[model samples]
Target chain A: MPVAIGLEGSANKLGVGIILHPPHQTADPPSPHDSAHSDDEAFSTRTQKHTSPPVQILANLRHTYNSPPGTGFLPKDTAAHHRRWVVRLVKQAMKQAKVQLEDIDCICYTKGPGMGAPLGSVAIAARTLSQLWEKPLVGVNHCVGHIEMGRAITGADNPVVLYVSGGNTQVIAYSAQRYRIFGEALDIAVGNCLDRFARVLNIPNDPAPGYNIEQLAKKGKVLLELPYAVKGMDVSFSGILARVEEMARKLETSQTSGGGPWKDDESGQPITKEDLCFTLQETVYAMLVEITERAMAHVGASQVLVVGGVGCNERLQQMMGMMAAERGGSVFATDERFCIDNGIMIAHAGLIAWRMGFRTPLEESTFTQRFRTDEVLINWRD
Target chain B: MAQPPPQQPLRTLPPPFNTSAESFELIAQGAESLLYRTTFLSPAQPAALKVRPQKTWRHPTLDKRLTRQRVLAEARVLVKLSGEGIVAGGGGRKVKDPKKKNDGGGDNGGVGALRGLVPAVLALDWERGWLVTEWIDGVTVKLGIYQRDLAADEGVLRGLLGRIGRVVGLLHLAGVVHGDLTTSNMMLRPTRTPGTNADAMARAEEERGEVEVEGGLEGDIVLIDFGLATQSVSDEDRAVDLYVLERAFGSTHPKEEGQFDEVLKAYGESMGKPGKVVLRRLEDVRMRGRKKSMLG
Candidate 1:
């Protein structure tokens, strides 16, 4: 068995996790969550023969850096927050795992495709730990970590993946040892649009902007028109974000000026903030689902997996389920524990790479901020 | 004793044209529609019937709205282009014909013709969500290129590529942008003689395992599948259109990627000055891969 400790601070969230990969054992009962495809005989047979040992999560913990309402987390502040918490989180995680120092095999950390400061903070912590524990270091791509973790948790074999987050929105499929991106947001990412819109409404970031928007959307019924821009499988959200922000400004001015409730032109009902949230979610999620469906049809894939932070939205999952069900397929998703940025996914993906004889020298363990998902060679898969 | 015949499964189409099932043969299926080959007006004239099935997953109102909008958009673009080409070629417009020698009659020097470059829209019904157009008989540019032998002479392939660029230039000149410009969306119809059907060509290529270089790459490029087309004259939109085709070509035919500049050269020559501006904008689009960098 090989045990790896993964550290991640690619964004406002700082996570620490320890994983144990037990040797392959025959007749090991399939995980209960593996019900995603229990009815598909072909998928079961195709996946069973080459399935790697199911990963064992020893300890996974995360701490988010929450800025005040109307403000986003800055790189400098977020880096300081991660630096302050990384040591404590690692110590707590190791203690929770109850594993001796010698039992650990390697240390893994997110290397790139994130904020420069936060990634650097986590990389430094990982380096110190690796030197102190005298373990090898594995650098992981943050996107690949999310993907591998989603697959391990959901057991979706050969699925077209829709990855949506604050910095990225991509429709991906595995082909020829690479996670090829078929289409993506042509401007701002779907999550970035939601977060900015939340700021416009002065919504608190206690949990997450997207989660707060989802809550507000649930109370909303009026479907105000928002610009829907989708080109082939690719989507654009900057236009929608601009229009919503303007609407928010107008709504605030009317309320602050002591005017009567802003009545909708046709319904005579008061236009509320919830309606804006509702419209934004509906339009953007539809675009995401549409692009994902296009990718599925293009690749002739029946299975789809949703991963990344925004993947935690229940509405997105529901809409994706509806789309997938129409094609005689189903959607697989994990809860916020795995969907949100986490260290376990980094540890899991890194460990798999480690098993394949990949290593990062001390001189080459630097982090970057602009790595693409397709840059990583997925050698672990066929 | 009398014996009864077994019942065959019937695939019913959407209303108004569902009575004749024998004439409709499913040809291709896309994300939003199903395409069928059928006869229109006269039995001998083949036509393509594109039926946009109602998406059950979406709200019924939204589904109907989208289907109607898309069907009308495609029909409008096709109709406009189809008319522009004939006006330039047939009536007193003295635009030099690329394929045939023109007997000069009247001067309409500035007009761009799309004749024989796009399928004519024979009929359409936006409410029922179907559009009928003249059927194009040929293999797609993707298959034509794929079927060509790797060791064959590159001149024919280059000529085909140039024609594709010129045709796209004419489309842009007519103020239309093909949002999705992949090789699979373009058909190579043999001049004067109808070539093999796209499906039959694939089967023949697979069986023969050889490229027939004599006439493999000669045809008039006909653009099809206008579901995502839009009427836009902006250089940015034209550049994006070209960018889409460029990326599609690189990914689909990596072997012939080096020769893609032939497309741009011909496009620039056809459009004169405006095409150069679009090509310049293309450099910017290529740097970002159709997306701009955002704050992390």
Candidate 2:
């Protein structure tokens, strides 16, 4: 059995995970019904009968940097933060997993769909480690890990995946061939939009005002009717962003223009932060769920998996759950352990590649802040 | 104890961004492709390396003329810019302590000279298509050198200019000209601490005559990114260099208004005969730039 260690540092979080698996363990893998070479032996053999057993929880640890949302997107800090934590996190995870460093099989790290800095750190660490230890290296897709973990937990044969996070928000569907992007946010991710809107509301992310907004939304009524734009499976939030800024201005209590309206300018605004928060929650999550619902209708699939940091949002989960119930489909939302970014997802995706004999040579260790997902042809046979 | 034995090997190394890169390992991705910090694998430390994927080189029918040669040319021009302090004072204060002076500087950091530019042709093996070179350390004046106090004093700046003049003179002497002379090419580094009177020291001294290259302690400057650099005898080529520098100074260090005139003064004091030719055309280029800025 070849051992695989995982490192996920696409964004601010530096997550490390290790998995020891019997080589080529999967007996039943997703069929290559989506690709053109459906009848090929190599393609067929790639699909296996045995899945890596559920008991294969290796070592996993995630460390996050306190970067201000929207602006914490610095490449240098991402690299520096990863450098600070890679060795320590790996050692800690190894200790927790009760495994020695020498016994590791290969190193796997996120390849792309991230800022340049953090991705570079993980790549550098893995390149050095693989060379020193004489182990193979594997680069994993940041998005695939989320979907893989979704399938591992939910057992969704085929489903609509809503990849909603800080940098990406897309309606995704995996055919027998490949993951097809059905619709995507035109500008920023849903969570990013919400975070920016929250900033306008003067919400601090010390404890992550995302949770605060959820709590506050529970106590207030939706007085402001905001724009709810969903086109087919795609959605637009720029109008929502502009309208909210206007509402913040009109309400006068918006506390914009650096300081709030004084006694002379105070008009006793109609909407409070609480009301705005409630309406925001109602609007954004509804847009996401509606888009996912439309994607489901287009794909004719019954299951949905919500991944990324926003997957942990209870409001999003509840709304998704309600939509799933109405459509007679199931929605799989990751727990906090899996949410908020972690290395286990990368490791999970890595385990699949390791089983398929995908390995990096000693001479190759680099990070692409923007590597393509579909470029590396998946050897779909498990 | 701080210095390792000359023979000790490095513990870690830079990685290749792509799997196919052969010579230089991809250290990080740049605006275009993966930046590879190469591994010399010898007793000496390897300079920086970057890998631009071969796939991106595939141009449609429209852009056949723009080639890898263009990339090398751009780097060469940048190297020249660094030498002139148009990028920043070479090996001076800005690079030494970059966290000083943030009162009201309107500059983007990392607008400095090439930290190192020896142009070592390790091997003509760019199979992976990368332009590997030394990574300069000093941040740019755009970063607000005052924010980090990275500005070198007048003595250091003079040392920087005298050295820079000789470099620009060498380029003209070598028959090559830098098309772009923006200060972003400048490398501002900290000077070694002086004995005294450092407080009253300014960056640019009042130049009235020929450069006094005393003590033979000339500063270091490296030009980079020679995309537009071309061998030239025409007055237009050299004038463009001064023009670019003037624009860079006006934009980057806005507080130092008319500072471009001071740089030309220093440049004139340094270049001698050809310097006068460049100076005569500098005014023409300035008027053209002003007209373009207004029209745009």
Which 10 successive residues of model 1 chain B have the least lDDT summed?
A: B1-10
Candidate 2's displacement at residue B254, Å, is 56
lDDT for each of the candidates? 0.78, 0.56
Once fitted onto the true fold, the runs of candidate 1 whose alpha carbons sit more than 4 angstroms away are A25-53, B1-12, B20-22, B59-61, B84-112, B143-148, B151-160, B190-218, B250-262, B290-296
lDDT of 1 by residue, B2-99 (tens): 00111224446887688754488777655667778899889989999989877765545566667776787777667666664346544523222233
lDDT of model 1, residue A207 = 97
Residue A292 error for model 2, in Å?
Answer: 1.0
Off by over 4 Å in 2: A22-24, A27-55, A68-73, A249-269, B1-296
Candidate 2's TM-score: 0.50
Writing each residue's lDDT as its tens digit, candidate 2 over A108-222 gives 8888778776787788888887778777888887887777766664556677898887766767776534565656664456766777777766666655556767778887553
Native contact fraction per model? 0.21, 0.00
